[model samples]
Target: MKKNLLSIIILALLVVNIGMTAFMMLSVMTTNSQTAKLISDIAAALELEANGGNTGGFSGSASGNVGVSNIATFGFTGDDQLTINLKPGSDGKAHYMLVEVVFSMNTASADYATLGTSESLAGMRELIKGKVTNTLSSYTIEELQADDGPAKEKILEEVQELYNSNFIYDVTFSSVLYQ
Candidate 1:
């Protein structure tokens, strides 16, 4: 009777192990399939670019100047530059950061007409400065100093969220200096 009970327990354990193994295998297979699809999509996009195709709409590519090492500086945006001054969220040491922000846009943007005029541009600049200052003040010195950090993305998102009429395509930090 004891031998029969032991045999049953061993069989149950083996069954549970087999079930878990099957579940893991299925999950892996699903992940691999999705990865394959993503690779194909990326390949197709690259092929089109190589063939000199006008890939309409945002290409979802990084738009910034490649600076020394990995640091990027993007001050190439024609006449639309917004400079901001703020102190990063400091722990002890006092550090101030100067940020030159630029937005990439086309003629179709809603803010395009207003940006051309000095009066309207001034108004927009005020809005930008206010939003950017608020955004920048939230980041820590370490975050701002990183090569690729979440602070930049957060700043862009916050600024864009506040000014929807600006019709911003991409936000670039033209220049960043910390002192």
Candidate 2:
């Protein structure tokens, strides 16, 4: 009788351990699937924005009667126009102006063509916008339009840092209009 009871107790503990392990595994799998779905949704939204499906969806809330509109439109191949409405940042005493920038990839080389062939335009668009926004926000209007080559080089470097993918070689700005 003692031997039988000991065997049953051990079996029950083993069963419980197995059940707990299965539960943990299922939880991990569910979390991973949810993360993947979220990433997919973000990618789709970026693609839609890049392809010019809906520009108005990107707008942020207006503050102090100052609205910042994100007017983005696809231009020619490899080119995009982004209009940003600027408002005074916390300090209500700065001159706020809207800036519209049209940026394009310089696809004038054989290397560029090879890179373009490998990636979809939508992915490239997402990559470029992230790079441009990070780099351009630091400069004043005067610095961005400076005739000196260093300013342009700096911009390109910033883009390159963001995109280490071999598919992107250089970035060019076709237009920068400030209002």
Candidate 3:
């Protein structure tokens, strides 16, 4: 009787251990699968530039001179530029226009199209242009100069709305020319 009880206890313990190990393995597999899926999703969303090897720089100095590096090298992949004309404000001082913009889509192939389909890209371009125009119109020259935080937020919100996805990872001011 004693021997039978001992055997039953050991068997129960072994079964429990095996069950726990299997559960852990399954959990690990699930976690890894999810991670891989997330990585693929992000990669698809980025449409990462093939020429990420290219490093570009831009300077928005107080001197109103815009200097761009790598702009010429990369060339124009999509809509090349966004130019806005600002009217002098009511204060009679020519206020610098705040134009926030993103560079062209890094679409090297159909699989790497960041801006989605051509139709979506067209709509997004128009939406972005309109948003930038509207956001800039609201800011005075002083505000543009002083509060970069709000300006950046406005740009992000507009871009996110325009893209209809969180795909626009960043919004960079390609050029800030005050005329």
Candidate 4:
């Protein structure tokens, strides 16, 4: 009788251990699934922004100190009037895009002398064009086709990071076309 009781007790313990293991496994799986869902949402937002659906949805809120109207007056702008070809996305078709960008400057910032001066940027036109060309070539067609913007706003964002802080206070897209 004692042996039978011991047997029953051991079986119960085994069952409990198995149940606990299963429960832990399910808990871990649920957390992983939730994390994956969050990642998917963020990826969708990035894709939309790349296609221009949500321009400012991601990062860097605008500096209220710089207003939109000031772009033409104080901004240094660049235009890729010529069409650019981008890498094909999953669609596997040739993509063409044209973009015009307005880059703003802060008068109070130290970068003004170098990047704020329209004449200085004008002299660097070829360099700017090279940067744009390289940037555009890196994006996929679907990214440019979403409507009014290109992937990453690479032109404005990259230039600022590559040059100096506040050298680019704001970036405005004048025109964007994808086909």
TM-scores, in order shown? 0.48, 0.37, 0.42, 0.52
Model 2: how far residue 176 lies from native, Å: 2.4
Clashing pairs for predicted structure model 4, backbone only:
none
Q: What local distance difference test score does each model get? A: 0.58, 0.48, 0.53, 0.63
Q: lDDT tens digits, residues 11-115, model 2?
A: 999999999999999999999999999999999887665433433221111111211241222322333355433333434433322333343333432334554
Residue 68 alpha-carbon offset, candidate 3, angstroms: 19
Mind giving the per-residue lDDT tens digits that candidate 1 earns over 1-179?
Answer: 99999999999999999999999999999999999999999998886653334433232222222333433222324344443444545477666666667655444544556643446555666666676677777666676776524655555555555554333435677777676
Q: Please give the range of 10 consecutive residues that has the lowest summed lDDT in model 1.
A: 57-66
RMSD to truth, every model: 11.1, 16.1, 14.2, 10.4
lDDT per residue for candidate 3 within 1-179, as digits (tens), equals 99999999999999999999999999999999999999998886554332121232111111121234312111112455545544465577765543436543223322225555656666556666777677776766666666556765676556655554433334566556554
Off by over 4 Å in 4: 1-64, 67-80, 147-153
lDDT of 4 by residue, 1-179 (tens): 99999999999999999999999999999999999999999998876654335333222323335555444333224534646788877878888777665555656555566666768777766666667778877888765556434443566666655664434545565667677
Give me the overall lDDT of model 3.
0.53
lDDT-based ranking: 4, 1, 3, 2
Q: Please list all clashing residue pairs in model 3, or write none if there are none.
A: none
Task: Choose the strongest candidate by TM-score.
Answer: 4
lDDT of 1 at 86: 42
